[model samples]
Target: MAFFTKEQAKAAARRSENMLDQVAGLESYSDERFDVFLSHSMLDQDLVVGVAMLLKEQGYSVYIDWVEDEELDREHVDKETAERLRQRMRNCSSLIYIATDRSGQSKWMPWELGYFDGYKDGGVAILPLVDTVNSGFDGQEYLGLYPLVNQVNQRLYVEDASKVHSDFWAFVNDPSR
Candidate 1:
Protein backbone atom coordinates (compact mmCIF):
# COMPACT_ATOMS: atom_id res chain seq x y z
CA MET A 1 0.00 0.00 0.00
CA ALA A 2 1.33 3.44 -0.98
CA PHE A 3 0.51 6.79 0.60
CA PHE A 4 -0.02 10.38 -0.48
CA THR A 5 2.12 13.30 0.66
CA LYS A 6 0.87 15.98 3.05
CA GLU A 7 0.86 18.51 0.26
CA GLN A 8 -1.34 16.33 -1.95
CA ALA A 9 -3.74 15.70 0.92
CA LYS A 10 -4.00 19.41 1.68
CA ALA A 11 -4.70 20.19 -1.96
CA ALA A 12 -7.49 17.65 -2.06
CA ALA A 13 -8.94 19.04 1.13
CA ARG A 14 -8.89 22.56 -0.24
CA ARG A 15 -10.68 21.43 -3.38
CA SER A 16 -13.32 19.70 -1.31
CA GLU A 17 -13.81 22.73 0.91
CA ASN A 18 -14.26 24.98 -2.08
CA MET A 19 -16.75 22.58 -3.60
CA LEU A 20 -18.66 22.33 -0.32
CA ASP A 21 -18.98 26.07 -0.15
CA GLN A 22 -20.29 26.19 -3.69
CA VAL A 23 -22.97 23.62 -2.87
CA ALA A 24 -23.63 24.50 0.73
CA GLY A 25 -27.44 24.46 0.64
CA LEU A 26 -28.02 21.41 -1.53
CA GLU A 27 -28.88 18.97 1.23
CA SER A 28 -32.51 18.96 0.19
CA TYR A 29 -31.53 17.20 -3.04
CA SER A 30 -30.31 14.15 -1.16
CA ASP A 31 -33.27 11.86 -0.52
CA GLU A 32 -31.41 8.63 0.19
CA ARG A 33 -32.74 6.52 3.05
CA PHE A 34 -29.39 6.67 4.82
CA ASP A 35 -26.81 9.42 4.66
CA VAL A 36 -23.89 6.98 4.43
CA PHE A 37 -23.07 3.29 4.21
CA LEU A 38 -19.89 2.94 6.26
CA SER A 39 -17.87 0.01 4.92
CA HIS A 40 -15.09 -1.39 7.06
CA SER A 41 -13.35 -4.57 8.16
CA MET A 42 -15.00 -6.38 11.04
CA LEU A 43 -11.61 -6.21 12.72
CA ASP A 44 -11.89 -2.43 12.84
CA GLN A 45 -15.24 -2.50 14.59
CA ASP A 46 -14.18 -0.10 17.30
CA LEU A 47 -12.96 2.58 14.93
CA VAL A 48 -15.96 2.10 12.67
CA VAL A 49 -18.34 2.53 15.60
CA GLY A 50 -16.52 5.66 16.71
CA VAL A 51 -16.82 7.17 13.25
CA ALA A 52 -20.50 6.19 13.07
CA MET A 53 -21.20 7.79 16.42
CA LEU A 54 -19.49 10.98 15.37
CA LEU A 55 -21.55 11.16 12.18
CA LYS A 56 -24.75 10.39 14.06
CA GLU A 57 -23.94 13.17 16.54
CA GLN A 58 -23.72 15.54 13.60
CA GLY A 59 -27.30 14.47 12.69
CA TYR A 60 -26.28 12.17 9.90
CA SER A 61 -27.95 8.77 9.60
CA VAL A 62 -25.25 6.15 9.14
CA TYR A 63 -25.65 2.47 8.31
CA ILE A 64 -23.18 -0.16 9.47
CA ASP A 65 -23.28 -3.96 9.32
CA TRP A 66 -23.13 -4.40 13.09
CA VAL A 67 -25.99 -1.97 13.71
CA GLU A 68 -28.27 -4.03 11.50
CA ASP A 69 -28.06 -7.44 13.25
CA GLU A 70 -25.35 -9.20 15.23
CA GLU A 71 -26.44 -12.69 14.22
CA LEU A 72 -26.01 -11.80 10.58
CA ASP A 73 -22.65 -13.36 9.82
CA ARG A 74 -20.88 -11.49 7.06
CA GLU A 75 -18.21 -14.13 6.65
CA HIS A 76 -20.69 -16.44 5.00
CA VAL A 77 -22.76 -14.45 2.59
CA ASP A 78 -25.98 -16.34 1.92
CA LYS A 79 -28.47 -15.32 -0.74
CA GLU A 80 -30.59 -13.40 1.75
CA THR A 81 -27.56 -11.65 3.24
CA ALA A 82 -26.35 -10.66 -0.21
CA GLU A 83 -29.73 -9.19 -1.04
CA ARG A 84 -29.84 -7.31 2.21
CA LEU A 85 -26.41 -5.83 1.56
CA ARG A 86 -27.48 -4.81 -1.91
CA GLN A 87 -30.57 -3.11 -0.57
CA ARG A 88 -28.55 -1.21 2.01
CA MET A 89 -26.08 -0.11 -0.62
CA ARG A 90 -28.91 1.16 -2.77
CA ASN A 91 -30.50 3.05 0.09
CA CYS A 92 -27.43 5.01 1.11
CA SER A 93 -26.46 8.30 -0.48
CA SER A 94 -22.76 7.45 -0.26
CA LEU A 95 -20.24 4.79 0.80
CA ILE A 96 -17.30 5.63 3.01
CA TYR A 97 -14.74 2.82 3.08
CA ILE A 98 -12.63 2.79 6.24
CA ALA A 99 -9.31 2.11 4.53
CA THR A 100 -7.29 0.73 7.38
CA ASP A 101 -4.65 -2.00 7.13
CA ARG A 102 -7.29 -4.53 8.13
CA SER A 103 -9.61 -3.34 5.40
CA GLY A 104 -6.89 -3.93 2.84
CA GLN A 105 -7.39 -7.65 3.34
CA SER A 106 -11.12 -7.57 3.98
CA LYS A 107 -13.31 -9.84 1.89
CA TRP A 108 -16.38 -7.65 2.27
CA MET A 109 -15.08 -4.09 1.93
CA PRO A 110 -14.06 -4.42 -1.70
CA TRP A 111 -17.28 -6.25 -2.50
CA GLU A 112 -19.34 -3.52 -0.88
CA LEU A 113 -17.42 -0.83 -2.77
CA GLY A 114 -17.88 -2.65 -6.07
CA TYR A 115 -21.59 -3.10 -5.36
CA PHE A 116 -22.07 0.59 -4.61
CA ASP A 117 -20.03 1.60 -7.65
CA GLY A 118 -22.22 -0.49 -9.95
CA TYR A 119 -25.41 0.71 -8.31
CA LYS A 120 -25.01 4.47 -8.83
CA ASP A 121 -22.18 5.14 -11.29
CA GLY A 122 -21.01 8.61 -10.15
CA GLY A 123 -24.16 9.44 -8.19
CA VAL A 124 -23.02 8.02 -4.86
CA ALA A 125 -20.00 9.51 -3.11
CA ILE A 126 -17.34 6.84 -2.54
CA LEU A 127 -14.83 8.05 0.00
CA PRO A 128 -11.95 6.49 1.91
CA LEU A 129 -11.08 7.04 5.60
CA VAL A 130 -7.33 6.71 5.92
CA ASP A 131 -5.46 6.47 9.17
CA THR A 132 -4.40 9.62 11.04
CA VAL A 133 -1.15 8.24 12.43
CA ASN A 134 1.22 9.93 9.94
CA SER A 135 -1.37 12.01 8.11
CA GLY A 136 -0.44 10.02 5.00
CA PHE A 137 -2.91 7.84 3.07
CA ASP A 138 -1.78 4.40 2.00
CA GLY A 139 -3.47 2.45 -0.81
CA GLN A 140 -4.18 5.58 -2.75
CA GLU A 141 -3.33 3.99 -6.08
CA TYR A 142 -6.19 1.57 -5.52
CA LEU A 143 -8.72 3.77 -3.70
CA GLY A 144 -7.81 6.93 -5.60
CA LEU A 145 -9.14 5.39 -8.83
CA TYR A 146 -12.56 6.18 -7.42
CA PRO A 147 -13.97 9.31 -5.79
CA LEU A 148 -12.86 10.04 -2.22
CA VAL A 149 -13.61 12.52 0.56
CA ASN A 150 -11.31 15.51 0.77
CA GLN A 151 -9.83 16.11 4.19
CA VAL A 152 -6.83 18.05 5.55
CA ASN A 153 -5.07 14.89 6.57
CA GLN A 154 -5.31 11.24 5.62
CA ARG A 155 -7.89 10.79 8.38
CA LEU A 156 -11.54 11.88 8.37
CA TYR A 157 -10.58 15.18 10.08
CA VAL A 158 -12.91 14.37 12.97
CA GLU A 159 -11.16 16.95 15.16
CA ASP A 160 -13.80 19.19 13.61
CA ALA A 161 -16.56 16.64 13.17
CA SER A 162 -18.93 19.11 11.57
CA LYS A 163 -16.54 19.69 8.69
CA VAL A 164 -16.32 15.99 7.97
CA HIS A 165 -20.08 15.63 8.11
CA SER A 166 -20.78 18.64 5.92
CA ASP A 167 -18.12 17.65 3.39
CA PHE A 168 -19.52 14.14 3.10
CA TRP A 169 -23.06 15.42 2.63
CA ALA A 170 -21.87 17.92 0.06
CA PHE A 171 -19.94 15.25 -1.85
CA VAL A 172 -22.89 12.91 -1.92
CA ASN A 173 -25.43 15.57 -2.78
CA ASP A 174 -23.35 17.02 -5.56
CA PRO A 175 -24.02 15.16 -8.82
CA SER A 176 -21.03 16.73 -10.49
CA ARG A 177 -18.48 14.99 -8.30
Candidate 2:
Protein backbone atom coordinates (compact mmCIF):
# COMPACT_ATOMS: atom_id res chain seq x y z
CA MET A 1 0.00 0.00 0.00
CA ALA A 2 1.11 3.54 -0.65
CA PHE A 3 2.03 5.50 2.46
CA PHE A 4 1.58 9.21 2.99
CA THR A 5 4.61 11.35 2.37
CA LYS A 6 5.49 14.31 4.55
CA GLU A 7 4.76 16.76 1.73
CA GLN A 8 1.39 15.23 0.93
CA ALA A 9 0.40 15.20 4.60
CA LYS A 10 1.34 18.85 5.04
CA ALA A 11 -0.77 19.79 2.07
CA ALA A 12 -3.69 17.84 3.45
CA ALA A 13 -3.20 19.60 6.80
CA ARG A 14 -3.37 23.00 5.11
CA ARG A 15 -6.50 21.96 3.28
CA SER A 16 -8.08 20.72 6.49
CA GLU A 17 -7.35 24.02 8.17
CA ASN A 18 -8.86 26.02 5.33
CA MET A 19 -11.87 23.80 4.67
CA LEU A 20 -12.96 23.06 8.21
CA ASP A 21 -13.52 25.24 11.25
CA GLN A 22 -9.79 24.85 11.85
CA VAL A 23 -6.91 22.44 11.61
CA ALA A 24 -7.37 19.03 13.25
CA GLY A 25 -5.99 20.08 16.61
CA LEU A 26 -7.52 23.56 16.56
CA GLU A 27 -10.98 22.41 15.58
CA SER A 28 -14.06 22.79 17.74
CA TYR A 29 -14.25 20.70 20.88
CA SER A 30 -15.69 17.20 20.71
CA ASP A 31 -17.40 15.68 23.73
CA GLU A 32 -18.39 12.44 22.05
CA ARG A 33 -16.59 9.11 22.08
CA PHE A 34 -13.48 9.15 19.86
CA ASP A 35 -12.67 6.55 17.23
CA VAL A 36 -8.95 7.01 17.69
CA PHE A 37 -6.61 8.09 20.45
CA LEU A 38 -3.71 9.48 18.40
CA SER A 39 -0.31 8.91 19.99
CA HIS A 40 2.59 10.93 18.65
CA SER A 41 5.44 13.25 19.56
CA MET A 42 4.55 16.85 20.23
CA LEU A 43 7.44 17.74 17.95
CA ASP A 44 5.36 16.34 15.09
CA GLN A 45 2.48 18.71 15.72
CA ASP A 46 2.11 19.71 12.10
CA LEU A 47 2.33 16.11 10.92
CA VAL A 48 -0.11 14.98 13.58
CA VAL A 49 -2.57 17.61 12.47
CA GLY A 50 -2.28 16.29 8.94
CA VAL A 51 -2.67 12.67 10.01
CA ALA A 52 -5.72 13.57 12.08
CA MET A 53 -7.17 15.33 9.07
CA LEU A 54 -6.82 12.21 6.96
CA LEU A 55 -8.52 10.17 9.65
CA LYS A 56 -11.31 12.72 10.04
CA GLU A 57 -11.89 12.74 6.29
CA GLN A 58 -12.33 8.99 6.51
CA GLY A 59 -15.09 9.50 9.15
CA TYR A 60 -12.96 8.68 12.16
CA SER A 61 -13.03 10.85 15.28
CA VAL A 62 -9.56 11.48 16.64
CA TYR A 63 -8.47 12.49 20.12
CA ILE A 64 -5.49 14.82 20.29
CA ASP A 65 -4.03 15.79 23.64
CA TRP A 66 -3.20 19.44 22.92
CA VAL A 67 -6.61 19.98 21.40
CA GLU A 68 -8.55 18.29 24.17
CA ASP A 69 -6.38 18.81 27.22
CA GLU A 70 -4.95 22.26 27.39
CA GLU A 71 -4.26 22.03 31.11
CA LEU A 72 -1.79 19.16 30.81
CA ASP A 73 1.88 19.94 30.31
CA ARG A 74 4.20 17.43 28.69
CA GLU A 75 7.44 18.95 29.94
CA HIS A 76 6.33 18.83 33.56
CA VAL A 77 4.70 15.47 34.09
CA ASP A 78 2.36 15.00 37.04
CA LYS A 79 -0.04 12.41 38.38
CA GLU A 80 -2.99 14.44 37.23
CA THR A 81 -1.72 14.57 33.67
CA ALA A 82 -1.17 10.83 33.54
CA GLU A 83 -4.54 10.12 35.12
CA ARG A 84 -6.32 12.46 32.75
CA LEU A 85 -4.67 10.88 29.74
CA ARG A 86 -5.63 7.43 30.95
CA GLN A 87 -9.20 8.53 31.36
CA ARG A 88 -9.25 9.96 27.87
CA MET A 89 -7.73 6.80 26.46
CA ARG A 90 -10.56 4.80 27.97
CA ASN A 91 -13.05 6.86 26.02
CA CYS A 92 -11.44 6.11 22.68
CA SER A 93 -12.18 2.90 20.80
CA SER A 94 -8.69 2.56 19.31
CA LEU A 95 -5.23 4.08 19.35
CA ILE A 96 -3.10 5.01 16.34
CA TYR A 97 0.57 5.49 17.04
CA ILE A 98 1.99 7.92 14.47
CA ALA A 99 5.52 6.67 13.98
CA THR A 100 7.82 9.38 12.75
CA ASP A 101 11.52 10.06 12.89
CA ARG A 102 11.00 11.66 16.29
CA SER A 103 8.80 8.92 17.70
CA GLY A 104 11.69 7.08 19.34
CA GLN A 105 12.39 10.15 21.45
CA SER A 106 8.86 10.40 22.82
CA LYS A 107 8.24 9.36 26.42
CA TRP A 108 4.47 8.82 26.20
CA MET A 109 3.89 7.22 22.78
CA PRO A 110 5.19 3.79 23.84
CA TRP A 111 3.26 3.87 27.09
CA GLU A 112 0.08 4.87 25.36
CA LEU A 113 0.50 2.10 22.80
CA GLY A 114 1.06 -0.55 25.47
CA TYR A 115 -1.78 0.73 27.61
CA PHE A 116 -4.25 0.66 24.74
CA ASP A 117 -3.05 -2.72 23.51
CA GLY A 118 -3.49 -4.29 26.94
CA TYR A 119 -6.70 -2.62 28.03
CA LYS A 120 -8.55 -2.49 24.71
CA ASP A 121 -6.97 -5.52 22.96
CA GLY A 122 -6.39 -5.33 19.19
CA GLY A 123 -7.32 -1.67 19.17
CA VAL A 124 -3.87 -0.40 18.43
CA ALA A 125 -2.19 0.33 15.06
CA ILE A 126 0.78 2.27 13.80
CA LEU A 127 0.63 4.99 11.14
CA PRO A 128 4.09 5.42 9.77
CA LEU A 129 5.14 8.59 7.93
CA VAL A 130 7.96 8.66 5.44
CA ASP A 131 9.93 11.26 3.53
CA THR A 132 8.53 9.95 0.25
CA VAL A 133 5.34 8.22 -0.78
CA ASN A 134 6.87 4.86 -1.68
CA SER A 135 9.24 4.79 1.27
CA GLY A 136 8.82 2.47 4.23
CA PHE A 137 8.71 2.80 7.99
CA ASP A 138 12.03 2.73 9.82
CA GLY A 139 11.06 3.53 13.36
CA GLN A 140 11.75 1.71 16.65
CA GLU A 141 12.32 -2.03 16.60
CA TYR A 142 9.20 -3.13 18.44
CA LEU A 143 6.83 -1.04 16.36
CA GLY A 144 6.68 -3.74 13.69
CA LEU A 145 4.91 -6.17 16.04
CA TYR A 146 1.62 -4.30 15.64
CA PRO A 147 -0.42 -3.78 12.50
CA LEU A 148 0.80 -0.91 10.37
CA VAL A 149 -1.75 1.64 9.18
CA ASN A 150 -1.75 2.39 5.49
CA GLN A 151 -3.71 4.54 3.06
CA VAL A 152 -4.65 3.62 -0.45
CA ASN A 153 -7.04 5.66 -2.62
CA GLN A 154 -7.57 7.68 0.56
CA ARG A 155 -8.99 4.70 2.46
CA LEU A 156 -7.22 3.33 5.52
CA TYR A 157 -6.09 -0.24 6.14
CA VAL A 158 -3.82 -2.20 8.46
CA GLU A 159 -1.36 -4.91 7.51
CA ASP A 160 1.09 -7.20 9.25
CA ALA A 161 3.78 -9.45 7.82
CA SER A 162 1.61 -12.53 7.96
CA LYS A 163 -1.54 -11.03 6.40
CA VAL A 164 -2.72 -8.83 3.58
CA HIS A 165 -4.10 -5.38 4.23
CA SER A 166 -7.37 -5.59 6.13
CA ASP A 167 -10.19 -3.10 6.52
CA PHE A 168 -9.30 -0.55 9.17
CA TRP A 169 -12.39 -1.32 11.21
CA ALA A 170 -12.16 -5.07 10.71
CA PHE A 171 -8.53 -5.12 11.73
CA VAL A 172 -9.26 -3.41 15.02
CA ASN A 173 -12.40 -5.42 15.73
CA ASP A 174 -11.13 -8.80 14.61
CA PRO A 175 -12.86 -11.43 16.76
CA SER A 176 -9.73 -13.53 16.93
CA ARG A 177 -7.83 -10.59 18.32
- lDDT of each prediction vs. the true structure? 0.58, 0.80
Compared with the true structure, what per-residue lDDT tens digits does model 1 show for residues 1-177? 122233333444444444333433433322337778888888866566655655564567777766654456766879888777888778777787766667777887888888887787654433444544246554645576554455444333221223234344565565653
Consecutive 10-residue window with the lowest summed lDDT within model 1: 154-163
lDDT of 2 by residue, 1-177 (tens): 777787877987887775334433453334456888999999998898888888888788778888777656877999888887888887888899988898889999998998888888878888888998889777788887888888878778898878678899776455654
Q: Give the clashing pairs for model 1.
A: none
User: Highest TM-score, which number?
Assistant: 2
Model 1 CA deviation exceeding 4 Å by range: 1-32, 123-134, 150-166, 175-177
In model 2, the Cα lDDT at residue 53 comes to: 84
Position 50, candidate 1: lDDT: 57
Worst 10 residues of 2 by lDDT: 19-28
TM-score of each: 0.66, 0.88
Model 2 spans > 4 angstroms off: 18-31, 172-177
The TM-score obtained by model 1 is 0.66
lDDT of 2: 0.80
How many clashes would you count in candidate 2? 0
